[model samples]
Target: MAKGLLCSAMQMTWRWFSPDRTVTPRRQLRFPAYTPNAVSLALKSISKKTKCLPFGLRQPDRPLLLGGHSLDIVHCHQYLGVWFDSRLTFATHVHYIRERAATRIAALKALSHSNLGALYSVLQTFYSYAIHSIVDYRAVCLVEVLESLRLSLEVLQNTVLRVMLGAPPWMRLVNLRAESGFPSLQHRIWERTTAVIAQLCRHWPRFTVSVLLQRTLDRPPNPHPGGDWILLAADIVRKLDATNAICGGPDLPDPAYAPAPPWLPPLIRCVEPTTAVPRSSFPAVLCQDSLSHVAALSTPDAAVYYTDGSVSDDGSAGAAFVCDEWVESWRVTSSVSDYQTELVAILGTLRHADRHFYRCIIIHTDSLSSVCGLQTQRYTDNKYLTAIIAVAASITGQGGEVILHWLPGHVGIAGNERAEADARHAATFPVPTFQLHPSLSLLLRRVAYTVRHLSWEDHQFQIYEGSRSATWYAIETAYAPVTVPHGTSNYLLVSLRHLRLGFPCCGQMTNSNPEPCPHCFDISEQPLLHYVLDCPATSRLRCGISEQLHNRDEPFIWQQRLLHRHLPL
Candidate 1:
């Protein structure tokens, strides 16, 4: 299963690899260009940079247009125009065009007519429309010049909207004759669009087109029936074209897939449609390349880090253990913040626990909430907490044990100090514009990609280990019960009885409301069985530990028996 997964990932990744670019499972090499999916992935990842910036423009470092031949470029240009025209429904086009005109008028009337800002704004709008039309719509050719003209409103709107809505206020008013004269300029723009529509009506065979368009531009009704009218027009067009095709006349293909240029190189001819439906069996590109998911698994052991969440008077806090480095990292944020915020960052790191060096798992944190939350059988309440729990399950499902420990915040521990600095820096810094470590970024991409394709049930289980040097298990045993020696512990014990006496057991009301157990049950005053056989939290904690041990094919019943025997019976 591991090998299959790794292979599938590599294959899918390689499909984006052009003839000149290749990825080897064994060695590191950079591809000159990114795949469409890679670009999409990059766009999605931009959220990690900062929330302030708009994510749409977060493009790949290299341009997608690079490396294609002139013919490929020409075809691409044509395809783009068709795509844009087809993708925007008629009503969308009308709405967008109308909106564009309004914005354009607003920008033009913001300042005096002859100002540099006015001229620049107008020219930029036209330039953007022209370029976008050519590159995306391939609408430059004049076989049906009227069709391109039909798209004029959409083009104009896109340009003006960006300038008017997206730019600074000063810039928006750059060409305005006077601030108060703005409404007049907008009125003039409406007149201009109306005149254009008049021209289309004069030449076009379709009278309904004019009426429908006038409905959009003239503001026919309160709800703006332009969109529905435009859809009606499109339906008419499609029906007319279908009738023509049935009559053995020139068969007009549906407009959605934009027809390619009538004249192109023979090589650019459309391939025959596939006879069989395309199955998503491992992409062929993935099968051809070799990548081993298990290879990384076999590499010299790396230390596992376990971080837990906490809340205190000072702020939200977290503790982490770096197994290989034998360091504990912990932090305390301002108490006002939510626990889940800190948990996201910590859980993100823990999910990738095997990436670091050393064979040990060291936990450093004062977050009893996080530790208890993971150990307990209660359903997580917070959305972020639930996500973290799912990820923890995925990690431990692979026979890995996360050793959670508590550390006093502000006590000046080195790892905790570093973590605090990192956390504070993360809070203050804007989302990164770009990741410095591309390799790590790529690894993250692979994991994310895998997650998307694989269901939660089929997710890979990664085993977590502690430090490799100097009898790490032996060192761990010093702090653990004697039944488990020089190995990962197989039982979880907590002071839950004092925390909630009957909350996990009876679900009964009490005279005084104690703080509810963060792990289990909803009520604060309910008595809980924290001692031996009955406590839900304890039972859950025991089950989780036993499952981990059983996954490793180790005898955990003995450990459970020991814990049961040790309980105050």
Candidate 2:
């Protein structure tokens, strides 16, 4: 009877699993078997290429034969780059990642050598792509790893940072991380784990993992010997105050996998050049002239619809469409970004046009991103873009036409202004919910933003408060837009960073009893500040700078000058 049941199960598996002849048992296979009898039966009918790994605490007492050959019992196996041992501890996988990351760190050190002349940004990029990627691969599985193993990964990150910055070994890890703008591995893993949880929550019922997570949350707490990723993720969500943010509603659609249908009518786009002069910079008269030109180009009999989307300060999103027939507005989930809101607005316009069978529909929107996305017809993983294409194709396939016009927003256009106002109004007041799912990209972005702010706060209290860097911290608020410009030489970039961090190698900073300035004999205690502002050695150069400032009639603030605010000149 057991043999009959086994044969029946194998037949069913072959029939359903390989119905299309795409998968066959003849292919290379390795499976973990829970029982010795099952392993024996599986090996007898399988190809010699197959390998069986017996699981559970009990070992097979006797050797099992398959075609007169004894089967080999395996203790470890690799699948999808992750090693799984009989104990399921993931220690082997972590060790493998450490070794691989160490090799990549060596490569980074070679490239960042002084003779190679690689820029800080280039080294950072290599670290992110080569070293960090290897460490971050499948990090969600490492949540339950030993604390020692996790710290080993962080040590590798510190080594990479030191190589990139060429900082002394005495430098603090917090300062090095802040200087390089890289978060700690722990924070990164938390961010990644939270992002995955958000995605699973956002697409509940679609993924099996999501279903299991939901079940785990609903059940009474039980001891999990192997550690529970779902429970860990839930704890993180609560700590982040994102419990409400990740709750999935019943109305969200499953992601569309099929390609967009072809449209019969050509999509007409009147998009302005991306590099055109800024509308904000245009004079009032020019703005009016441009608006008039846009008004004149509208087809007399065609339906002209204006669309706009708004995002409030608190992250609530709203989209609205205005036309001669009606003005409609609705709010969407706060997790949707302003860009996706714009796409939703345009999508609404197309849906309306298709419903009423309008012959020619012209949509005026302020979102250049939406227009460009439609123009390119390359919707890569964006479910909204895919749906928009599908709807537009449906409209055009039925002999109707859709035209998209990109217009500068808030330029006193009547319909556009009404749409924008309605969108903002919808965002302010409770309106009909749009029933759109939270975007995965936007959710991940929120996680990243929260992690960055948390890291910054930690840095402020731990590193900035008790260090010599406090001097720069006091004055940092004075410089509103202090940023290192792209393409700066590595030497200048490093110098500026050191100065901002209050560790410049000046005599006063480096010595307890500093001597007078060697070049100008200045006796000021703050030698770096005096050297830039009052040194007679640089009098001729200062004269040229003062003349330029005088010509521009701007005040000569020594702080701003020292901060490289005038470097653009």
Candidate 3:
């Protein structure tokens, strides 16, 4: 009687709700196991043996009975597209995503290793389409699952990078990253999730999810805390630039774009910022070495040390000390300046000599400041300089003399050239640990740049009309760890900044004003977009730039083409 009544009631409601349409009771009903006849048919279509009741909710003492059918009881089941279990641990789901992404990566290994030049775009597309989706699906919620598996995920990403770049697995992490042009897995996750949160706040003005985020953030980090999400969001806001995302004071008024002050990470502050190192105080003897001198000095008991430091375009720094007996490199923190790296290298070389019991030291370097500092500033207030000066004074104590030689860099002076190579290798090889602290302002500026570009990218201003500029792309995308030609990059940077700030392209818009373009008249303000894309005056010049581009033939491509016109074919 209960079975008959339930079926009759369901049929009546189904019919009433679908008066004009065909209501297939078998197709639409969720718990169709109520009908055993239909269950056999449904079981035949699906590969599963049985299905579980809903988990994580209260259950009744009585068994579910409908249409005289008996459904098996289980602990885990798929409901409404997501899997649910008795525990709700989400371990199964995390394992699935990992396996799925790894499988997709394996499928692309052949294409990744292929010599397909232009088809590399295809490989990237495949990654974006097949693998990134698997990795990024529901990432905001699954951040903890991903974070715990970060080392494994990084290996997966590195595997792809090695295959894509045609590099061996033993290649340095820095080199693989530079070749593949991908940030770390952790960084990508942060950027993606935060950007999504930023997008959500923009699109949905009144989402209650902000309240959940706020409550989670208000609490502290605990093993059983709200989740890893709180820690993740707090990490981005604290270490990365959280305050600038939204308007107002400390406790952000709008919780959407603005993340509140993180509870986990203590605010970053430098106790004592690095000061300028004074030049050495002692009078230094300069070594004027010819080919013959170099040859003679490359013999026994001669303690000649080569020191060099390198700063790349992206602001990464490295210092190297090379001698027949000792060689190693130190990666400098981003906050450290190029000049400081040079001094640090020289200082390190002096310390190395002191440790080895070498009574006499001969140094060859390309840094003028390194040579000058030791040559004159013996009694200086600077702490780093004072130590270096003491090292200089001590070396000459027991049959010890110091020869500070200036070698022309990269002109085949064997020792100096080796030091330079080692410096570059150090900069581009291992990841920097940032053990040396630089000034607070420099770190703040770097954080600001990251926030601005990320906001810019999230805003996707590039797609808007008349916003495309070579300078913007070159600055935002190519500026990180990628070297741009110095002169051209500078011109592009200045042109773009000027154009955005309403500085006139010609004479009319600024204090250093020029006459307006003859064709556009004084009514129109001349900006970078105007000259590159719209201005009739530069049409011929723009046409010539377009013609020079071999790979691209569009109007917008002209902007970047002209920007990089100085690049070699």
Q: Identify the candidate with maximal lDDT.
A: 2
The weakest ten consecutive residues by lDDT in model 2 span 1-10
Error of 2 at 164 (Å): 1.1
Query: Which one wins on TM-score?
Result: 2
Give residue 496's lDDT in candidate 2 (0 to 100).
54
> How far out, in Å, is residue 508 in model 1?
53
lDDT of each: 0.33, 0.66, 0.51
Model 3: how far is 517 from its true place, Å?
A: 61
- Two-way lDDT contest, 1 vs 3, winner: 3
The TM-scores, one per candidate, come to: 0.20, 0.74, 0.34
Report the C-alpha lDDT of model 2 over 1-569, residue by residue, as the tens digit: 00000111122211113223222234333333324676677733442443334333335455544345454545655656776565566788888988888888888877776544687878989988988887677778777778898888888888888888777665666667766778888888888777777766665556877776666556554555346667776666655555555665322332532454467333545555444455556656445765765676677768889999999888788999999859988887675788889988988888888888888888888898787777664565456777777777677668777778887776677888899999988887665488666566766777787777776776677644576454343354222323555655556655555554455444644677667887787678777656655777655546657654333233224324544543211
Cα lDDT of model 1 overall? Answer: 0.33
Residue pairs clashing in model 3 are: 280-373, 280-377, 280-378, 281-377, 281-378, 282-378, 507-514
**Candidate 1 lDDT, 1-569, residue by residue in tens:** 01100011122211223232211122232232244676766622221211111111222233222123111101111121131232233333334435545654564446313222333334445534643233222222211223454556444534443343332222222112111112222222322232233334333425666556434333323343243434433233232222111111111211222222336221111112122423233444222211121122233443434343333444334333333344333343332233443454455565556444223333445454545554433332233345555544444446554444443344444454565555544443333321111111222233333333322111111102221211222222211222322222112122211111111223333334455555563444333322333355456546546554334333334344534544332
Question: Once model 1 is optimally superposed onto the true structure by TM-score, how far is the C-alpha of residue 468 displaced, in angstroms?
Answer: 74
- Give every collision pair in model 2: none
Q: Which stretches of candidate 2 lie over 4 Å from their true place?
A: 1-58, 63-71, 114-116, 201-204, 216-226, 249-297, 333-335, 375-398, 431-433, 463-465, 469-488, 504-560, 563-569
